[model samples]
Target: MNTAAQPPVGEKVRCLACGEVFDASISVCPVCGASGEWLALYVPETNAFRRESEEIFLIVGGGIAAVSAAEAIRERNRLCSIVLFSEEAVLPYNRPMLTKAMFDSLAEEALAIHPRSWYEEHGIYLMLSKRVVSLLPEERELVTDDGAHFHYDKCILATGASCFIPPIEGTGLAGVVAIRSVTDAAAAARRAEAGQNAVVIGGGVLGLEAAWALKKAGCHVTVLENSPRLMMRNLDAAASALLQAAVEESGVAVVYSAQTDKINGTETVESVTLRDGTVLPADLVVVSCGVRANTALAQSAGIETGRAVVVDEHMETNLRGVYACGDCAEFRGVNRAVWPVAAEMGACAGANAAGEAAVYAEHPVPFTF
Candidate 1:
């Protein structure tokens, strides 16, 4: 189960329009606007599987930490089975590239680090498009959407975070998208047409990235922020201004100190009205406001929660044999949800799950994306 690339009931399906391999069952594309139906089915030619001894059911919430943890476990326990369960379709892929490579016209290669055979040779099971619905920490088990439960010696909750969309009046409109994952990114591209007015809420990294991606996709992009400046949490005004100017130079609009209220339209987003009585027309609205960690499964299982899943220095939770990582876990009082740290934590969690004392020391990982 752990050493193969099949999810509980899923596999790779290549997209015909973008020519990228995406999870077939995942309804939407994160890179392209292609539907899952557009993902050409490649019927398995054979049932050949390369499995190993000792199954380690690793229920990963986010792909990066889950995959990194699997590699670390494989480094020590070569014969142990590794199951990498991710809600994200892409497995162990880099999140940073969603910004830099979004407009790269011919980039077929995904942000994934390892090839398919790498998992096969090493006996790693990749479960893409699999969302863990509940956790049984007492039983050391996790339940999937399809009602299948997996028992584990160690379980990693890398479930990550979901983008927070403000409770705006017109939020139910058709053209609004949350640019958090690949699915959102691709939908934004399709929802926006050439010369359409697109408004992005929040001036965070994902907002800026979505602006760039939408602009490349031929939409006129405008960013709305309630903060007095851009990237307020990460950069000072001067640095933010430099980035703002750069984005504006690329034909994107940046409006600061603007509080958003509702997206206005009949069936789709047409304009946005601010709390301060300002109105701006928009054909598409991308919400990159903030992120809330997905801890429902853990919370349901009675695991204590803080801002996120409360984990110790070793990525272990309050419960024994249960661990948390990625965007969901707050470890050693640090709540930074960057990609690199998630991978590091995952590796540590996996090692500990395999009966080793893996310490998850905090490292200052740079975050430009």
Candidate 2:
């Protein structure tokens, strides 16, 4: 039941896990290693921060999907009131760069997809650090975490998926992390010390990229993939083997069919134990299994969801004025959870919402090892 605001710039934020208070300047709790998401933000006593919105088009989420949809809507209708809500405090950036450039010191300006001025120029109201807590499709109303209600002519549920961390023992340790957002990458970077042992669970693209980042940061990296082959969803056995060899050549050990039973450590991760009694020493563990579509808000409002929010070719949900797109939506029983697919879906949803005829066709792009 925690709200979005808390831990103001200089205030002490309390950690829900361990009740430890720390400065808001640090995104992660130094006492228990919990990320900023677990810590509450500081909110003032006044209701001045409460936003009253009646946008013509309301988009939930600030990722690429939401941005694309906003642009499409504006392209179709210039004077439409478009409001975008983002759970993160910053502007939408290239999310893929978080893994690709983890070792590099990237400025916020470099990571942003569109500068702050760009949103204003395009007439898109970007509400940062705000989460839509509930959706009332019956009333065409949306409620944010801060208790602000908004009515929209049409709404897009583009809330993206979050990193899925398996229920593994010792995962709460200080060195354990996930590389999902810029904040996550920064937390992982802070722990990737020289000569440290880093274990990356799941040999998917995100995991491999994280392992490479740690390797470049001078950490001895090992990739543990539970399946018999790495990137099993996309790569064949031969391609998987070739990719494993290349990763090994870069001084990273790739282990297949490795079931991690537990992360062995008291407070900080010391090593990882496999099901076969094999133990790999580790100072950091990055879990990059996959993502679960963010469908809680839609489901709470009685929207049908099976793995993801159900949508038609027009990207409209069961409700007349509500639409869903990106990773949070499924069409004809298929949910293509990739950047390219998300962009296409966003465009289709935006166009159709703006009274234009648009249909989302499946774009099949095979995964490359």
* lDDT (Cα, tens digit) per residue for candidate 2, span 60-160: 99887898898778777776799999999889876767887887755676677678998999999999999999988777888999999999899999998
Runs of candidate 1 with Cα error greater than 4 angstroms are: 1-55, 105-109
> Can you give the TM-score per candidate against the true fold?
0.80, 0.83
Highest lDDT: which candidate?
2
Give the per-residue lDDT of model 1 (tens digit) for 1-369. 566444445576655554444565555544444674576765643312333458665766656677767766776676776787777666566565555455542122455656677788878888877877888776778788889988887677888877887788988889888866666556666676788888988878778887887888798888997787788888888998898789879998888899887788999888999988989989888888788887887888888898899998778888887888878888766677776577667777876776676567775554535
Q: How accurate is candidate 1 locally (lDDT)?
A: 0.73
Off by over 4 Å in 2: 1-55, 366-369
Winning model by TM-score = 2
Q: What's the count of clashing pairs in each model shown?
A: 15, 5
Positional deviation of 187 in candidate 1, in angstroms? Answer: 0.9
